[model samples]
Target: MRPSSILSGLSCAAFAILPCAAITVDLTSEDSIKSAASTIANGMMKFYSGNVTGGIPGLLPGPYYWWEAGAMFGSLIDYWYYTGDTSYNDVTTQALLFQVGDKDNYMPSNQSKSLGNDDQAFWGMAAMSAAELKFPNPPSDQPQWLALAQAVFNSQALRWDPSTCGGGLRWQIFTFNNGYDYKNTISNGAFFNIAARLAAYTGNQTYAEWAEKTFEWTRAVGLMSDDYYFYDGSDDTINCTELNHIQWSYNAGVFLLGAATMWNVTQSDLWRERTLGIWNATHVFFTSQGGQAAGQIMFEVACEPNNNCNVDQLSFKAYLSRWMAASTKVAPWLYDDIKPYLAASAQAAALSCSGGDDGTTCGTRWWNNGVWDGATGVGQQMSALEVIQSNLIDRVQGPVSNSTGGTSQGNPNAGSGGDSNPIAMPAAIETSDRAGAGIVTALILVALVGGAWWMIA
Candidate 1:
């Protein structure tokens, strides 16, 4: 049988046999996966280009917000990485230059003073991408990109404190307070990602050490009762309690991607364990078994209620899609889990209408009776679309595993053998470790969820 026909036949048979209301489509083959990825990329590029050219006004009106700019820059790099399209790179360069301004006045001083740690972390992600593309041989002599990343890292790293319940990087610098303040999972995870990337590019052990310590802190303090869901912080105090209560999609996504990056750079068993733990956590939340049955049902209903949910779901799915794209770079098995979600999301996006040049759709606003706006909503749509594209391409390219599990690839951390430094010990050994591990093990217990399924398929 022809490969495509065989896949189609298998899909039909699986749907017929499966009892679940929703069946995920597996576009595991190279060509089909790439085609899907291309579709996503085209959609994302169109949306981004539109925003840039006043096609979508107010989407990003002047003096761009750093985080929003970071997201756009990240998406562009992602597009370039998966598709190898120079246009995306060109867009990234333009975006970065626009945000940083000129060399003498790069990254506004006032903006820098008011910047939150999460904002810096997000920008770090974008800067790292730019640095990677230009490092050791940048197109120009300007060091603004590298300097900005390093300054952000240094500023945050200097503020890290063990006195805090968790020993990860702090969330921001307080104007009134002299010490580091609140620390969130996203902030810490972003630093880990940035540090790992910096270590890879510059052979800096300081960056590697910081990344490892940050990951360890997350495992110690952030692992919640569910094991699958990581809390942002400890719930001892009121502020901490408030922050620690909810488990967000992006927090897990950023942490997993960071862990994977750390493992790529530093082949440490700890980082590998962290990566696997995060992957398991993400799979639990996103898939059926994660106790998010209502969420899953809601996502399906909201995106295409009876296959009709629109762009609102795309906003949420963007986080998952991007995470899955990054995860697939390290763990191809994840692509299987995300396949169905991607198809559903793409189907909904294709159906929704936008008045833009590409005929791409705008994101949905649930509160406004499914109204479509052209601001952050469009950005969210483009982000998700980019992830869908990247993952599909990755699926087509097949798996390219990094030999080093968590050790640095180019530069091992000095005196650490490429291992990240450990954080201060957890206040008390939480009971959730073993339980979390058990839950993770249970989620992957099925034969279809293992490597065997990928091989057979």
Candidate 2:
């Protein structure tokens, strides 16, 4: 059976048990959102301190936690952008600095590069986030962040093996010792995003060119199928003969975001069209397929075959929501295609929440402790919440449009649509952004702690 068909069947089954409107879109105030963001942030911080960072208060664990860190940092940056909050910047900067301090240690001894695609990607993301914040009005020490990002770019660039696989990144630079082994869509997409973002920030056309080349290489190697679902890049021709066999949310998110960013800088119609296509095709995950929520559409381990639903799935969801929000900002015409999915995702997120003081529950159960691991599941839940929050804002405000005549809602600050309570919208939007940002920052710090704890255990 085609993977899409199989996923459709699974989703139908899951949705049978879930009410269509399980979640209410009543997140009307920024204060409420910010409060929730703060709760999530605190939970994340606790998780990091207890589990990932080896009981350390401020240090990062390593590559294992980098994905969560990068996601959280990205969310925080968005919060800073929306709210003009310097505190978010302060917290994010500190967390990033901690990661940078251990860069050399994380690098492989023999190759002087990152351990795997996740490391390169996450580190690259972290650097890009820092660069975005500091570039135009760089502080005295801001150059360090930009320089470190560039160094990571250089290291990751070296790991690209065009000869081994059809232009895909290796899973690792050293540890696996198999240079021409397995490749995955997430790796290539991530590298593409990192390179593209760096190119835009630096004004160097070379970075943009490299990003496009990597993107093309990914397409050529079968990481991306014609319909937009991704594949696990394995050389095991016997069991995994089809290149587009595996599809994951993160892969889609990374690829779509990368393509969009590249198009933004290069004005490449090819990239823009490809990104829009991927965005539309991947929307299947949010629909009611058969009867389930199509949650499995975001599964990544299909690439590894042995991998199962885990934290990465949650991470993928977070990435997808963020990508959707960001994309809507650039291409409002796509909002209608995206809004319903966001609504459905928000409902699913509400179901994931159980009764708690915070009103959000960790969706997955943790094996280590009969209760949810605060860092892993909690962060995932919060990430989903932020997406829901963003979607709510967009829907109520109406869609803002591009010059081509497609309309989407204007910025929340402009107060164009929605129920315009003079006192309500601004506070709600700002609070939501701040809360989400705070939670995300805390989650990153917590993931670092969780990684350390996991590593030591």
What TM-score, computed on C-alpha atoms, does each candidate reach?
Answer: 0.62, 0.66
TM-score of 1: 0.62
TM-score of model 2 vs. true structure:
0.66
lDDT scores for all predictions?
0.47, 0.49
Writing each residue's lDDT as its tens digit, candidate 2 over 28-87 gives 655554454444444444444422434432233432244465566666655554333455
**Candidates in order: C-alpha RMSD to true structure:** 12.5, 15.5
RMSD of model 1, in Å? Answer: 12.5
Provide the global lDDT of candidate 1 against the true structure.
Answer: 0.47
What C-alpha lDDT, on a 0 to 100 scale, does residue 248 get in candidate 1?
Answer: 46
Model 1 misplacement above 4 A: 1-59, 62-64, 101-107, 112-114, 131-138, 144-148, 176-181, 200-204, 223-228, 233-243, 266-270, 284-319, 331-359, 362-376, 395-457
